[model samples]
Target: MDFAFSEEQEMLRSQARSFVTDRFGAERVAQLAETEAGWDESSWDAMTELGWMGLSIPEEQGGAGFGFLEEAVLFEELGYGLYPGPYFSTVALARRALDGAPEQLKRLASGGSRLTLAWIEGGRAKLLPETGMSTQAQESGDGWTLTGEKHLVPDASAATDVVVVAAGPEGLGLWVARCEDAKIEMDPTMDRTRRLGRIIFDGTPAEQVAGAGDVRSTLERVQMTAYAALALEAVGAGQAAFELAADHVKTREQFGKPIGAYQAVSHQVVDSYIGIELARSLAYWAAWCVAEGDERAPMAAAAAKSFAGEAAVASCERAIQVHGGIGFTYEHPLHRYYKRAQWIDSFDGFGSVQRASVATALLGS
Candidate 1:
């Protein structure tokens, strides 16, 4: 399949790049990362005004009716800009969790309200339902009550609603509950730009979203989507790091000569370029599979995430190395990219986990 972006997709990328450059420049992003909210509401409002909040929602649901490819285009630019916020949680995870719930979907897509997924338990990230057995849902009066603690929930404090993955008497299920019903506490995070929260749901009222049937399959699909988005986000970070390194090497003089002229620095920069290109190819392919609903999407997503995660982290490290001592300082933005790359590499599933997923898909488990 042709992985090249279409004209419209290119236009979308151009627009996103321009918007991020104008609205979420480096200084603004840095300021927001230090703020209590960790995100700019006006920037989010502008994105909503541009219809980006519902970029992937179906047309029938009051969205732009675009596919995952378009969504990937937007996320890639967002990552490049380091536009901190709940875009990943709201659009990638929460929207998919509320797939059948049109009313809630519309409200979330409208952009004022935010939603996040609470899947991790006891600070462990488990993608399979069998492993997510800590959180439990019990039948209550006219509804279900969730009683458990979820840790490392992304953007949980800013979320108006949370889709909780829990185990019940029958089987694995998904439940939606208001964030206000649970105790949300901010957690320490490696990447300060992204907020992580711990949530305790003590008999919190919830409405079942998925019950019976193969709920694990649904969870896998959600994971696949998230993996693809994260892969593209990693690719974006890699691109940014690569550019930063390349520009620095060209200008920074060592022994009265540009460092880029040195074979050692030049070779590392070339490796970063090659890594970014390879990861970008796989990420775009995975995005296409997701957009077209291809059967190999799960495997493709795994491959993309694994490779892109490694590549992005490597590229950021190379950037730091190329920049020399200044790169390690907090005053430099390259460290922020490196930290964000590490954060993205660890989210949903890490490099080893994703590679294991690919192995499972290839060989019968």
Candidate 2:
């Protein structure tokens, strides 16, 4: 299927790129990473004013009423910019995870609240298990009490709310809880731009949402959407790294000529460029499948995620190699991009897990 962006979508991309270039440059991102919140209030407010948080939300739910495709366009630009904020956790993960909760959806669309997901437990990152979930939810008066710890929850400290998946007497369910009510400890990670948290819940109050579908099915659907969004983000990062390397090779002199003039350097750059393009195509296709609710979305998302992640990492590595020792230094911005790509590639399901998912879809589970 053709995944060409509409004229309006292209315009959005242009606008987003301009915004990122002006407001979210590497310097700005680095500055934000040094802050306590790891983001700028003004920048986030500007994004909210632009209706980005509501881009994929339905109109009836108090959003701009755009589809996932438009959101994907914005996500790629955000990735390229290396945006440091909870936008990914709020929109890409929480919004998609809690679609059945209209009131919370409205709050998110309006930028009145920020929510993140807490699902991975005890180093289990591949899939949400049907059983043996450490977090347990017990029925309380008019609500539920969640108990246990969640590992590596993105933006937990920054979010106002958290969507926690826990096992209950009725099986697993999605529960919404106040972030303040839980013990949130930020973990030191390679990607300081995007914060991760270790969240512990001891008799924390929560309200269940998304009750129509089976819990595993709902979680799987959320994961598919996340995979597509993350793939596109990785593609953007890869593109940025490639651009940086391409520009560097053309300018940095060696033997009184540009280093890019050498076939050894030029060939590597060309290979990276080709990989980014391929990853971009697959990522966009996966986004399209998700937007259309196509039956093949699972397979498409897995394949796109698996390939895009590797492509992005390879691009970062090649960029470093081409830049020589400077790229390895902390002062250079290339390392930041590399760290961000590595973090995203491992979040939730890594490349190997995604590839296994694709294999299962193609070969028979």
Candidate 3:
């Protein structure tokens, strides 16, 4: 089978790249990163106008009617441009939680509401709910009341609603809580481009979206998708760093000669290229698996995320090294990419967790 993106997918990629490049310039992104919201509303509005917010939703639900592949393509571009916002949290995480809620899905697809996933508890990254979840969802008369603290919730401050994963009397359940009901505190992050917050739910009323029986499946699906998306983002960031380093070495001169002419510099560039290519291949393969609902999606996603995350960090490090002192400075954009790569690498789970997932899939757990 041909392992290339279709013409339509390529077009979507091109469109997304152009939109990010034009809309989120480096200076503009930097400015937004320093703001309290950590993102520009105007840019988000522009994206909504472009129908990107609804890219993966069904056409019947007021969406663009695209599949996971299209969504991956867009995210790859967003990663390359380092577009800062809650788009990933809203579209990738919360939107998936609205699987059975048609009204919420329609509103999200129409960009009429913004929601984020508040699943991480105690600042620990976990793939399963059986891990260290302290949040509890107590059954009330007709609703549920959640009481617990969630740490490192992505874009919590910007969300109108939060989909929280909590342990109930019956087991794990997915609960939707209004942002107004929870106390949100912005957390300082290394990558200011991406916002994170701590949400405290003190007797917060919530609506149950999925129960214990179905929550695992939903969480697994969300986790796999998140891995795939993050892998693609790593690929994008790695590719960008490789290009930046390659361009810098070609122009920057040392000892009256271009640094790229030196074997040491050339070798690093080649290494970055190789790593990026490998990560890109894996990321695309995982994306295709997810889009097709293939059985190998979980394994592919784990492998892709592991390799891509490392590749991105390596590429950024090499990029900074190639640029010498200028790269480490705040004035240079290379540091921004490095910070973003580091943040993405730690998202969902680290390389160790991903490797464990791969091992578990290969060997019987």
Q: Pairing residues by index, what is the TM-score of model 3?
A: 0.96
Superposed model 3: Cα runs more than 4 Å off: none
Worst 10 residues of 2 by lDDT: 123-132
The pairs that clash in candidate 3 are none
Per-model lDDT? 0.87, 0.87, 0.87
Q: Is candidate 2 or candidate 3 better by lDDT?
A: 3
Candidate 1 matches the true fold with a TM-score of 0.96
Candidate 2 C-alpha lDDT tens digits along 75-131: 899899988878888878888877778899888888888889988898565555646
Model 1 CA lDDT for position 262: 99
RMSD of 3: 1.4
Residue 275, candidate 1: C-alpha displacement in angstroms: 0.2
Regions of candidate 1 where Cα sits further than 4 Å from its true position: none
Worst 10 residues of 3 by lDDT: 123-132
How much lDDT does candidate 2 score?
0.87
**Backbone N/Cα/C clashes per model:** 0, 0, 0
